[model samples]
Target: TLSQHPDKNLHKIAHTRSSTGPLAERVRPNQLCDVIGQESFLPESPLGRLLVEDNLPSLILWGPPGSGKTTIARIICRVTKRYVVKISATKAGVKEVRIIIEEAEKRCALCQPGTVLFLD
Candidate 1:
């Protein structure tokens, strides 16, 4: 279930899972500058500029396992200070999307920060 205050768990989620989760999670980069191998998306690039402006548009990150898709999403959420709602597209149906959208509408009505619908 989506929490009314999703941002409340942002810090807790990032810190708590890294300690006991997989090695990859434990060593994941917390900032865009710390990521390697994807230099095209780093600072000085268009994506980097957008991130700096905090105006990153809806994007789709497609990559194989072990890639930095989730890591990038986390960094975006943190940098933008937005609520994140992660959903697995493979398993998600219209029902899930409707729920997320509805929650986003509520947030917007309240003048809260935007929600990042990170479809994994």
Candidate 2:
């Protein structure tokens, strides 16, 4: 689990060299402080404070290509101990979303970690 205090862990996320993915995924920042260019979302910042206090609320992150939007969402999930369900809006239709929501509901009923839908 991540430390609630944002200033503490300014280190990179640990992963094995065997992990395979796109370059961005391989190099993604696991810690909030390790994320660059989005200081407003850092733990010391207001938004970061809100996240620490209230947990993650529904949000639509907008940024240019290669920005840290996906990384931020995944980090939030880790911090909150939630399972992330990533889907691209262009590929997933309403039925697919409904299916995810239903599965999430089932997980919630089983007292599992809540789901964080990361619609890209």
Candidate of highest TM-score: 1
lDDT of 1 at 35: 79
lDDT of 2 by residue, 26-91 (tens): 557877888889998888898898778746667788999878888888888777767789899999
How well does candidate 1 match the true structure in TM-score terms?
0.71
lDDT of 2 at 51: 72
Index of the highest-lDDT prediction: 1
Q: Write the per-residue lDDT of candidate 1 for residues 1-120, one digit (tens) a residue.
A: 213435555445555665778655755678887777777568799989888887777888888987788888888877887788888989999999999999999998999978889887
Off by over 4 Å in 1: 1-19
Candidate 2 ranges with C-alpha deviation above 4 Å = 1-16, 19-22, 102-113
The TM-score of candidate 2 is 0.66
